[model samples]
Target: MAFSPASYSQNQPVLDALSRCIAACEMCADACLHEDHVKMMVPCIRLDRDCADICRLTAAFIARGSDHAKHVLRECIEICQKCADECGQHQHDHCQQCAAACRACVEACQQYAG
Candidate 1:
């Protein structure tokens, strides 16, 4: 597979942030599922799922230069912030990592969206 910088050069920051957030959300969700008290991590798991989905959608919208990118970015910021807040409450390594990634995503989104 040939890599093409021209394919995504325009909105690289948003793309990079989305990719990081998606990976972080997936990792956090998997980690939460492994905890002894799965019930307690349910909120974190749910938020991770939501955040991952939105991040993917946002990236897709941006990649294609869709007219709805603005709307998607708006939603992405909210979800990322909520996910970060939830993850920040936990002391687990995965949660801490996820919180940091989500915060980074928040900053990227703000730059592009606001």
Candidate 2:
């Protein structure tokens, strides 16, 4: 029983957003580590990691049609928002991109949860 998101009508958007967010967060975190003042990006890096992990878990829950998906989505939204806020504080290209991705994920998750 291979789980395919295509079988779930409304999950595609949320899944797409989550995947994008995960990629963006990972990239941002990696880039932040390379910045000259890595110390300044501690919060952003932490949030990015947390957001990516939660997005991955949320995507899995959604893909499996778990009863707890909604609960997990609520947490995902919170973390995504926090990550976005932290990323938005930075002017780096990756951070800005990550912020946009996180915001998109939040919107998608909210719609899916509704």
Candidate 3:
């Protein structure tokens, strides 16, 4: 993807980090849905989906070189944090892995959002 940033180099790190976060979120969402207890995994599944969507949009915003990328980054951080908290509640391996991914995404997004 090409981003038309006012200053390209300034946003490169943010763009890269957002891309990783989006990938993680998508993987985690898929993992959660594969869990045996479908009913208990509902919230996790939903949050994972939400987080994935936000991360993707944030990446696209940054890629397009839009000045509004910061706003999406902030929102993505919030969603990642929430998803991490929810996933952290479970003892399953997938949940634990998803939580870690979300936390990483949160930190990365926060750094860029600033």
Candidate 4:
């Protein structure tokens, strides 16, 4: 579903953070693919994509005010944390940025999930 921040006014911060995290993860994954030792970045790339997907799903849940949003957000927090850890291990700028974004998302998700 198309996500609009205005439609989910109560969850606006969480949605905004999710959107930023998604963008950062996508960029980081693409950059990882271009790295000289792409093999070493396999985990990072995978986690980046996973985190982005989870964030997207979480946003949708929150937007719809679904009964499962808390459950989905719990999973979202885990994936975002894993992605941040993996990306933080890398020295690349994109990875660093993605890690930061994921961290922000995690905080937002936590607040919303609670």
lDDT, candidates in the order shown: 0.91, 0.93, 0.76, 0.92
Candidate topping TM-score = 2
Error of 2 at 60 (Å): 0.3
- Candidate 2's residue-wise lDDT over 15-111, tens digit each? 9999999999999999999999999999999999999999999999989988788788899999999999999999999999999999999999888
Query: Which candidate, 2 or 4, has the higher TM-score?
Result: 2
Per-residue error (Å), model 2, residue 106: 0.3
lDDT of 1 by residue, 1-114 (tens): 122347577489879989999999999999999999999999999999999999999988888777788888899999999999999999999999999999999999898774
Rank the models by lDDT, top first. 2, 4, 1, 3
The TM-score between candidate 2 and the true structure equals 0.93
Ranking by TM-score: 2, 4, 1, 3
| Candidate 4 Cα errors over 4 Å, as ranges | 1-7
* Model 3 clashes, total count: 0
Global fold similarity of model 3 (TM-score): 0.80
- Error at 50, model 4, angstroms: 0.5
lDDT of 3 by residue, 1-114 (tens): 334546577667766766665666677668767777778888888898898788788878877767787777778888989988998998877678778877887876676656
lDDT of 4 at 10: 62
Off by over 4 Å in 1: 1-7
Higher-lDDT candidate of 1 and 2: 2
TM, every model = 0.92, 0.93, 0.80, 0.92
Question: Candidate 2: worst 10 consecutive residues by lDDT?
Answer: 1-10
After superposition, the stretches of candidate 3 with alpha carbons farther than 4 Å from their true spots are 1-10
